[model samples]
Target: MYSIDETYKNIEAEFKPRSKWDQGVKETALAVLDSLDMPETVLPDHFGSRRALLLNGADNWREYSYGGCALVYNVDIAARFFTPSEMRRYMADGHDASMAFRGEPLLDLQARALSQAERVISRYAREH
Candidate 1:
């Protein structure tokens, strides 16, 4: 039942680091969140209605994504989730497709993430 702000605070504290780079990145993320006009409460359906979560990335993104998914799952907000590169090849084809025609690595990653998010949302809508 934590508000999004409270959840973010908890995450910030959990990610507090001794390394300068990590600390800086965490601070930047929190600052961006703080500047946004967000809802005071976390919506019940914030993670989607059908309980499927798709998270992308390999390194830091994977860690943070898994952590958030675990937190939501702990609170009964997520029933199932998968980190990128964990599933079968067939299941990963869509993500691969997102990178097919992209030139830049960053743009390809962004497109892949967007594609995955849209897929998750659409699948959730259909299943629920």
Candidate 2:
């Protein structure tokens, strides 16, 4: 697994601005993404799968995006296994948040992504 520092360095070095005005946004976004784990493969067009993988304890999955931005934790285990409230708080105060008011949106974005992933997993489990 890539340590947070290593991930951040890679993200920082690899992240490029799509446009001149996006430089700072991309940098700050990558910084946030680097702090968490989200897979590059399953990421929906605008979502991060790595965060879900990490949260769900998916082994060998250690990548992230600006926020993994949105997430949906299993109600049965979320409170017991992770700190959703604390996560929300941090999201409100984290680097991306400091950079732009838009950062908080990641919370909702990732939640939806997680929900979709769970549905897919559930369907697969039922089939096999």
Which candidate achieves the best TM-score against the true structure? 1
Those runs of model 1 whose alpha carbons end farther than 4 Å from true positions after fitting are 43-128
The TM-score obtained by model 1 is 0.31
The lDDT for every candidate, in the order shown, is: 0.36, 0.36
> How well does candidate 1 score on lDDT at residue 80?
20
Model 1 Cα lDDT, one tens digit per residue, 85-121: 3224314446652232224333333333334433333
Best by lDDT: 2
Deviation in Å, model 1, residue 23 alpha carbon = 0.4
lDDT score, candidate 2, position 29: 40
> Model 2 — TM-score against the truth?
0.26
- TM-score of every model versus the real structure: 0.31, 0.26
What tens digits encode model 2's per-residue C-alpha lDDT throughout 1-107? 34434444444565454642244343434434443454342323212453454344432222122233322232221222225554354355444432222343343
Which ranges in model 2 have alpha carbons more than 4 Å from their true place?
34-49, 53-128
